[model samples]
Target: MRRRFSLLALFAIATLPLLVVLAQTSDAPTCEIVAPDLGSYIGDWCAIWIRVDDPQGPQTVENVTLTVTTSPPKSKSFVYTTSRYNDTFFYANLSLPYGRLELTATAVDDSGLQGSHTIWVIHPFPVPYFNSFDTPTIHFFESWGEDLTNWTISPAGTWHVNYSNYHSPPSCFYTGPFSGPITITLVSPPINLTNWTGEAFLSFWSKINQTPSFTIPPTDYCCVEVSTDGRTWYLLSPYIVGYWSWSFFGRYSLTKYVGRIIYLRFKLVASSSGGGAGWWLDDIIVGNEKKVLVLDKLVKHFSCDSLDEWTYSGDWSVCTSTYHSYPSCICCGSFSGNKRYTITSPRISIPSVNDGQDIYLRLWWKFLIDQDCRVVVQLYYDGLWHSIGEFRSSLKRWRSSSFWITQTSGKRIKIRFMVEGYSNYASFQGLWFDDVTILVFNRRIATKGNITGWFSTENSLWRVTPIRCYSYNFSLWWGDTSTCLCYYGVSYPLDLWVDLRDVDHAYIHFHAYWNFTDPQSCASLRVCYDESEWVLLDTFMGARSSWTTRQYRINGGCVVRIRFQVEVYSSYAIGFFVDDFAVLPTTSDTASPNVSIVEPKSGAWFNFTNVTCVWQGEDDVGVCEYEVRVDGSSVAVELPPTTTNY
Candidate 1:
């Protein structure tokens, strides 16, 4: 019987006492390995602690063991028993070579029921330098042996490193104050450039604050040089002129010297008698190539050979003639009587200051008048129409118009040419508009004096007379009246012009009353920047009467024209009255004055009585006087010039 016993039977007999002790418990023992988190790098020594528990009782757990398996072809396993107080703890003294190691801990109960947990640890080798200077001390190198006499590595020179000054943190090397003539070279540690096979670049942020009085000689300047071997060096960058502001210098390709280890050095040579502030460098990165994106300026020309970049409404036709530069030009308005036609160009995008440019529009136009027909140029921007200038061809000669587009930076805008005719009394030859072009100029030299005359109208000083007025009742805010009769099948178009040379915004307030029989009969109020096309502001149909106020924020153009048009198609319309038409221009007011009329609400009606008028006015500078107007008319009441209320 002793000769026939197997190896498995012998191992069971050897552990029979421990198995018998664990059989008293019902549940398996649980083990958890806590110390040395995943991906943790372990050096010479690492502490590992694990907790093992048995639901039956702590005494039911017999032993806890730890095993470490090292990764590689040399795969070796190290096993050890840990000491336990409440839980098991293992202080591992790792002796294997550096690599990845998997540590597993197992708890075996007295009944041979086991539970285990495993974790991976990484042990990485050290490198020389990839320093950002984010820590207290520099990690890589000490001072070089040869560079101490003329060049100093002190921080408190004429150029110092502070949080606001330096491109990166902590400190940077500086070389300055050589008294007379000196040439010094600052060297860097050897960088491995063999791995960078593709296009490689060395970039750094540098600032040089040379005194304005110090005149730098042509031969004496700072330059960058690279060295394959420590003894020989090649010039990498051009001589950089010393300036006061921090600027970026980069994209120096090292494609020629790709497969070699190299060293970068900065050579500073100064012959000037005056000692001045030197250069400061930070955030030196040597890596792959980097790309930067920028916006391009646009220039467009439409010869009108075809209608490729143009849109039209109503009747617009193109004619081929030698009157313009190109073979063809855009022509409109050949109708007999009462026709509205428009030709709209494609939208063009305006380059903003961020795109490093400014923009302008230019065009040539002419009109042929039989009775009362005009050609107008208008700009479409920010969902509104702006009148640039208006043209009526009494001589049928081509005229040119060019204006700087101000308020449309970083926006898309379009151009429109509108031709309108009112009477069919005679055979009329229409309007001609052609040769459109747009130009984009660089903002570097043109950006100065960006504050153009934003508010040209000072204290409502400028007033505009209506260019053309037709069948409408007109009464002054405080003066006389003109009357016209209501009639069907008639069209009335009133054109008013305002000079917006330096104006930024204009507020127009008026009282309007309209009574019409047909639902299609309407009174439309429109504005234009170039006066070539009309943009409708408000349209009133059927019967309506109210005091309406509208604000026009003007962009960069010289003139603004408004047109009030009333057309009755089938039935009678009466009392189309528009009064108290006021143009108030608030120029570029840096600080707005506070104004209040406490006595009456806006659009409030009053009767003849003993009424006390009160107002409150204040400004950051000082309120000069309160100009009180009753019913849109200034009352001639004597009061103090500095009076805040009436």
Candidate 2:
């Protein structure tokens, strides 16, 4: 009884302190833009203003920052201190480029709570930019507005991009629920008319057919305005309410803003106390010269045609009820675990004679997969299926992709699109295909950019994610290690392999940056002789959360593939980063093979019709094949180099 009482007393003592602790609740800091009138612009060298507050108290706010972003240019960040806040605003002065920009304001409290907001604004663009509505974000459509889309920007044309109407086809900018009153403005690409070269004019097509509103003050209105500094605007076209038809509004002179950088504004409003179809504009051309607007070049490989030529083994059919696109698309929604569903194409055979041009298959597709599920594009040749490429990421937008058929340039083949599941997951996923186009070219056009070292993370859990990185934070490798759920005693290695192809000696160098909270992880190096089976060379599981330079030497041959395998038992932290993984081939085999016969000893052979003969061959890189010509007749020309008596 004394021993039991003592153990109980110790247990109570161990947890007694935890019961009396007071934990302070942390609230995310509130962040709001106070200056530059967010979603617009300020001076190129002026400061940005923001207002930050914390629910706990102002003292809880630790850091406030603003990130000015422009694609193709490195983003810049500015810090905000409490000293910069003058009771009403937090000022962050920065020198930013003129044009369309995105400002992201973030606030962090002392307890790591954060709040952030991002808004797009106009800076300016050099004049003469053009837009034909084919590619909305192209340089010609340099507006930081969400009102532009190649397709419908919003749904059902509720002041959004819709399929109902386009100056071209398939896309346009629209503005309004019209259920109430709304005002939307779209800015044009930057134009620096500081150098007046020739005649400068604005050209576009506009359409509006509202059945007038009951509000007499301003029923529905659209006007063209010009801004020299992106903030102060001067009306160029009077507010034309109840503007009708798809009329060409053109030849408006923009020579007045010749001494400064400028941006054209399209301001639209609808006071639809009673409403109708909203306003739309397309084919915007602004410059020192006028250009004709033409139809958008459509490049659809297979126009939503019949599916009679395609064959599928699972539940795949044409779907039309969806709102997105591809009025006719091959969709596969039904799934079975540990099974592969494929959609096979009819025979895609080249001419009997071998042509030298490379074969490419380009298509538009979208897919979403659960754990261990993937979509693989394959080609069937010589009675086998070859996986040329695979997609593992869960993509929401439609993707256009092209893959080269490696080494099958002159062969007759058929293409296969398949989806595979590795486990019995209950989550729902979908795979859809819009069109497939086959093209032949003298050279391959595309290359994989995210190849870590010489290895590809296709069809593996190891991939490049923005979660964590050692450098270039966006597309760095995370090497997420996974374990197989269906197979016991097996782990799904975060793996990437490269073909060494007959080289037996090489050195691998890479950088490892780890952020692990007592992780039970393994960084295993392996080699694959054949395409499938892998052999472990070594494993590394040192201390976690540090940057280390890793170098490994490998000795393997003949279709050799190097792999970095990772298996995670459990994880608590961000990422195990793999950077600059590369291999250095050290094999220098330039000498000829040394061969010596070891049979028919000194003319004392047996009295047999066919005498058995043997020879030994050796090379620095190992012999690929043994060719033996019996009296110049090529009797045993094809033999394995590993065997001399076969």
Candidate 3:
């Protein structure tokens, strides 16, 4: 019988372990201390544990939370979910205060059964070593998340907020029935960002729902105020008050003392002059969110570029709109002078294309003017019509003029041309345009000057045309004068002269007419250095055969005797004309040098019986001087003295 009792006792002890687990499992799993067996875990060493369920057969738990309420009951909720007949685990690694930490894990299923376990957290504490230094200050846009712990947030409300692009003015948010002065609070205190230049704005989507809001219903007044400190506030200008039914999502901008350690607040003084329904505000955006100035291109086609078409940078289109439609101007030709042979291409809508970017609408025009005339270039901007820079052409030369539209309003821009006549008839033929370029002028180089005579005296003639009529020191030789010589021929040399006053540099230019016959008729440019010496500085030939123009820089001092000698003429012969003569530094005296040096006692005996002499001679205008010594005496001399050169 004693032997039988021993067997029963063993069976009872074995069943007791299963019973303990069954009780815990029937409700919720208890967090069992697996690693660092309870008493063995003395000092702070990561304590971990696991639970074994011998009963309760795979039960799911709900409302499972971890409450670490030590001296203070702080709790963090954890979601515990498990498939039927499966086991689940709960884990956390937190720095508990160096006291008795009361850790409780509880689970309540949807059926509402509660099971909890408490662990005593004690720490002898391993002395942790920490070194601190100034970490780099991090900056993030308003779009960044709030969970960034390593970074510091300034201007309070940076924490407990999130950003989403889904919003209209998209911004940061915090769940709240909270309203107070928004401020700049450093997340990592003691680390201050000095002279910070941060700007933030509050943008919300609002719409005038009812008609009263649009008609200025009774009592709504709103204002945005800012402050350098969280306390003292200053009201900003332009406050919204007395609403109308049409006013919807409202937005206010505040920018005065931003970047400063300041606070911003939005206050609505509800005063319904008589008081009705207030407006609704949604999608509020706060924090540093900047709106990008977006530019949208509307009509890209400016013109139809046919064979004689124009190339452009952006999408090219025929400028067309409701008010105006551009004509098929692939090739621009003048129909007549009195009636402008104008082909109006469509207009294009350009919004904000003037943002420090280059804008050019280039078109080519083969201006075959049968007579002297001017072509008017027009441009439209800012709801008004205007002209590109004015350009007039009489010959077959290609010319371009541009206008400026400070900022693009809409995408549409128009370019128009008009032929105005100062004379009988004018026309443009064989005109073409490829790409357009808009030149931004920072500063323009000075390029205008007086008329100097053309070197080609015979083969080339300067007609008294409006664009050619220029007065200079040489104007005395125009007509009915013995000195004013005009000799006309096919290919030959001609002498032209102008009595230039004080001048340093003279700009010489000429235009050659090409009939395509004389393919070789070219003018050789030369300046007479002395009475007999002609220095060929540059040459203008048939390469510049088509409406040819050449500019030469002549050093001013001696009066220039200019000459143009034509090399050859052929079947494709054409007449050449030159105009637009300019002399720069018009005050430069070109008179010959006069010198009489005075110094060192002329012809006087120096030390050790050596004789020395010096004299100073001054020229009323310019002096090209050199020193000459005869019999050991310094004296006024000529440059490349006659004795030396000879």
Candidate closest to the true structure, highest TM-score = 2
Across residues 280-378, which tens digit of lDDT does each residue of candidate 2 receive? 776565543322221222222453345688888877888665422324677888575787788888886543223434344667776766556777888
- Taking the tens digit of each residue's C-alpha lDDT, what string does model 1 give over 1-646? 6656787788889999889767745577887777778756555467777877777676676777889875532245779877665543433444433356678988887778888889886553221101110111111112212122223232324333334445434445455454326565666656555533444567666777542333434555777898898679899997875564556676676667776777788766656553456666764555543211111344677777776678888766777763365357877756657776788888887656545454557666665566556566688998999875444333245645454464577788888887776566533476666667776644321111111111111221111211111111113111011132334555555444455455566554445555666777777777776647777778877775544333333443345655566666653345355543445555554776776666677777788777777665665333434577878888543323223221
Model 1 regions more than 4 Å off: 1-298, 354-358, 423-428, 442-646
Please tell me which predicted candidate would have the highest lDDT against the true structure: 2
Can you write out model 3's per-residue Cα lDDT over 1-646, one digit (the tens) per residue? Answer: 9999999999999999899877655654444434434423233335344343323444444334556543211122223232222355544444343333445556555444566666654332121110011110112111112222332444344334434321222232232222222222222111112322434444443222121223343233444455665566676424455433322232244334444444444444333232323333333323332321112222243334342333332222342121111233344434545544454445555544344332334443434444455556667666676654333423232323223344444456566655554554644443444334332211111111112112223213322221211221011112211223333344455544433324555555433332223445555667773437888966554433334334455665555556655544343333334443322223444665454544454575556755444443444432334667667998854332111110
Worst 10 residues of 2 by lDDT: 131-140
* C-alpha lDDT values of all predictions: 0.55, 0.56, 0.39
Model 2's TM-score against the true structure: 0.24
Question: Which segments of model 2 are wrong by more than 4 Å?
Answer: 1-301, 322-326, 351-356, 426-428, 443-646
Q: Rank by TM-score, highest first.
A: 2, 1, 3
TM value for model 3: 0.19
Residue-pair clashes per candidate, as listed? 18, 15, 83
C-alpha TM-score for every candidate: 0.23, 0.24, 0.19
